[model samples]
Target: MLRTLTRFFVYVQTESNLKRLSLCSAARTGSAMTEPKLYRPPAEVRGMTSLDKDAFTQTITVPALRVPTGVLNKIVKSLKKSTIQRPGVPRVVQETEESSDSRLLLLDPNRVATPSSFSEAEAEALRSFGVAEELHRYELKLTYDNLKSEEVLEAVLPPGQDVTSAFSRVGHIAHMNLRDHQLPYKNLIGQVIMDKNPGVTCVVNKLNIIDSTYRNFKMEVLAGEENMVAKVKENGVTYEFDFSRVYWNPRLSTEHQRVVQLVKRGDTVFDVFAGVGPFAVPAARSGASVLANDLNPESHRWLQHNCKLNKVEGKVRTFNLDGRAFIQGPLKQELPGLLRGKASVHVVMNLPALALDFLDAFRGLLHQEPPCDHNLPTVHCYGFSKDDNPDTDVVKRASRSLGLPLEDRCSVHFVRNVAPNKDMLCVRFTLPKEVLFCSDEEHAEEPASKRQKCEDTTDSA
Candidate 1:
């Protein structure tokens, strides 16, 4: 019993030494105790009347070592990872006077508060370099210019509130949808955004939800120049337009490219609600004949401009007409010719808010004569749903608008989250033959009744 107790005490002492060495090892890497914050904004700063850069100026103390210039290289090599690692903070303080033969090496105060904080390996290296065993104090003056946007915002906002300074960049414009609470600091947020992001000349925040009619939301310029024309590049294609007058969502660049990829050479594409020709121009560039149309005159004007800008104007035929008219007129005329041809046809309706409703225009679309070509046009329709089962909800709406059920026939793809409980989705499928070539009799009956008849007709004849 006496021997076992003695062994236990010896083991405890060994464990304690191991822990001290482990802590010393962590200190050498500048990750020891809680770091003293460098960003110190003025107290009682809440909502700023204006961004006061001078108010956030402060000074901080960090542990550093005064080393001789003769052995500076050796000392720095020995310190290795022990040097301070803050951005904009220099590791070595250059000697101001040419006569001075020594410089101060900045050390992370959190890790090297005492002389014994160095690990055994680092300590032996320092001693071999003939360096002093003591750490000196260095005053680091910090200001709003020194602090990062996130760090600055955190100090200004009330504790516990999330910092939402992130914005989507569209050319020289920074577009944001500021929350109600964040509106009070909108100017400060905008200024910080412009300061941090390079090449951003203007900042704007959406005032309300996107307008359903024109699809462009009202926005107020928060900071910088109030230029609304934005030039943005996506998927190697550059487009320029008035951001305030036309609808452009940079987030949908991936979705735009995804649809454009499907249009192979010799194929044809019809962009029913083409806003600035994101789809039409790219598809045209890929050697596919494109017919692009938009009801918004501003969107139509820019669609033509973008097509020319991308040098695909000749490839894409532009039309300024309502979606239904574009469909019943140009699309109806083109579908017959495309049906008889060998190339694949694609119809893109990307107006997410009310695109599904426009699916009805395809019903009895080919009224003159139903062509025999089975290479039906593929429809890529986008919609927004707040339902738990967004996929099902989108498909149902698409089917309802088309007067045909598409639950099993169509493929639903999750696009992105527009808001809480709201999702933007894309439903893709070949336009059903029955819906496309619905006769007078077929149109008289309920769409559900025709689903069975259409299936039976395929089986019978």
Candidate 2:
């Protein structure tokens, strides 16, 4: 069974909209000075007024502070003071930063001391004033510390709160607690689902559960219509999934679209870790012949199904094999003779977080001579920024490992963020002429010092 994990952060503040009411004490029947009678004024006010009983009235101005949208609405409804004049913008009651806790409640002006916990008194106050109903209407923003607190538990509400129903309406849902390592899968899956493109079909898992060997389990659509159901068989075990629980990342689809736009007609595109054909399908649709390969057999099955679903069977070919093995195995023997040295292959490594480990395999595909023909195969290596240094260091390390120059010819394109503090970037370069000519010299030169620096930095982080 797949277990879902979520984290939430909540910040409490005074509401931005505050109701200001003016009330006068009840009149005295007989006394030295009679008190004024209190009366509720109209909802809308024309202008400010002076107190009738006071000889002189003083006006006070207060500074305003921004408050959470959820907290602001509660304040306005609870206070039933008469509106003699239009209410001004709410001023911040207090502006002090506090560490996040499980539950927080702001105090009423009438209260002598603010409550520290969600006590019975606080609950009664909230219930009496109907504040809980208003809170349920808006999603709250939580701080990091609050999200990780033991007392706070995240909850998921189905569309319209269909608590007992299995099938219902489709709407926006939120999934949190995605760790940094799992973000790529989350992002890539999220993109396809949100696109809602008829040409795309995707299955996403909100949970992250890597197998014993550190491989992520494949996602399958369990109980939808024929076209919607995702079928998969792996290691003699079959699993089913639903579309409602899974989320699609909008950013990943945009990136995929960008890559498709870059391709020209009749180009051959290579996707190393082409899980379920996110890259392949788009490339094929753009009129490029796509060679999609993944080590996971389940992924290859989905890739084939996706190709047919998108009506791009003729343009895409799915291969179930390790990326490194595919390059050095059958493809290596067939490429030289099949293309007659005129292959214009464009290799795409979208797995930047782990693409650095495959630099040698990428170098093997590039041409060994100068005036490099565009028809000849070349690599577009992708990787993430080093933790302790700028992302250029990733390019430097990969280039040096492949026995290439650092700055003269190589180009680095920094893509958008795949996760917090991590970016997707591509390094494009051609193999140097010296690659074939100075074999002995290349071997004799010591490995670039930057390679060690990268390993050390990553290890430390």
Candidate 3:
């Protein structure tokens, strides 16, 4: 008899009505609800072993309403907030074993564990529809198979433990930096992450820090395929690179776009340490003439490929050179001509670990003064500092590297915190004439070869 077009379901799940679990009445209007209920696994499902699906199964009784099938659709629409809204769980089920022509509309078990959750507005609406309501009891079984990944993890993870849900999605890979306490549950976490997220086939845990010459780190696969090549899109530009051989931080996408927006058509941009062209590709697409370089050959290859991939290969000139050499060689030669033109000139030093130290190479970079104050190239240099005052610290460091004071001349921008105390910052300033045009005394102190060895390089990023 419950075979009519609409199956009637009434769920009584809300904070205001949880106290009233009894037989339903036609006008059993619920109290005012303050908040919506989010689905959480029953407490009995905690401390799971190997994410056991059977362990999460539970039988629970919920308040229901028996309504005529003719008004089922209208009632379901009206009781939208009162129905079971789980991801994979259906809100409607068959009539009770009594086999009446009416359907038992089950309320959200988590909210209306008992009954009387419908609001005064709901009762008046039902009265207008001329549908009589009586709360019925229904036993429903919930299983782990239907729980969301967050709910599943929350239930199994120890109380007070740090959440491990945040991960960097690089193409199909979910890269996680697991803490010591979470290491034991890494596999379980990876499995759940891959299971819940579509198009994510692999999960990896970083084993070491990203301080290599190439800025890449070693990682152990926790789940899924071993594929390392990743295709990613940032700032509307596509890039494909070998994730293990190069450094790619999804967190820096906003920072990259921030600097690129300053470039206009006919402008010139030098991207030293440009890993896979995150800055260069988009800047070139913006009609700027770009010179992109990276010391890592893999980064260079991918930079060229990404330029072509984004159809900007013709606009970008790719180089495989050290950060300092790119500044001293191609950039030095190209700047003189571009600086004379009216278009803007910009240099992007993005290797946050070493870019600050490389600023010394810009000293005496151009043998002549810029044609005009406005024509001087602006440098966007990145650095990492753990000092309590990072803005002043970065400006001082850049000034030290350039052999001049920049405290009053340069503007420091806080980028992102790389770790607990370490912060990444970008210092922006126009190249000073004093540094670009070196005095005889300053020029004879040392050669580039000798100076490169004595600088403050690091146990850092």
Return the top candidate by lDDT.
1
Separately for all candidates shown, the number of backbone clashes (residues 3 or more apart, or on different chains) is 0, 8, 10
Question: On residues 1-461, what C-alpha lDDT tens digit does candidate 2 reach at each position?
Answer: 11111000100011111111112223323321112211122112112121111211123221121234455555434322310121221222334355222122222222211222234654455566445522111122222222111111111111232111111112132222333433433443233232322333332332433231112323433212224333332222222222232212223545666666677777777787776776787788778888888776666776787788678889987788766666655455444443444435676766554565665553434243233333445567777663444356777767666656657777777555433344457777654434423444344444222211121111101
Q: Each prediction's TM-score against the native?
A: 0.82, 0.46, 0.82
For candidate 2, the TM-score is 0.46
Q: What are the per-residue Cα lDDT tens digits for candidate 1 across 1-461?
A: 55345444643443342101111112224444334454346564555648888888778887888888898888888786778776577889964677388899988666676778888988998788888878777778877777767666766776777763446678999887666778888888889878877799998988766665567777899999999999999999999999999888776888898999999999999999998989999899999999999878999999999988888888999898878889989999888878888899999999877788788888877756754538899999998776777789999999988888998899998776554345679999999988888776676433321111111100000
User: Model 2 segments beyond 4 Å from truth?
Assistant: 1-175, 178-250, 330-343, 363-374, 431-461
Better TM-score candidate (1, 2): 1
Q: What is the descending lDDT order?
A: 1, 3, 2
State residue 209's C-alpha deviation in candidate 2, in Å: 6.9
Kindly give the stretch of ten consecutive residues in candidate 1 with the minimal lDDT sum: 452-461
- Candidate 1 residues lying further than 4 Å off, grouped into runs, are 1-35, 65-87, 95-102, 108-134, 371-373, 444-461
Q: lDDT, candidate 2, residue 281?
A: 79
The RMSD of every model to the true structure, in order and in angstroms, is 12.7, 19.5, 11.0
Candidate 2 colliding pairs: 9-142, 9-143, 10-142, 15-72, 190-248, 190-249, 191-249, 222-241
TM-score order of candidates, top first: 1, 3, 2
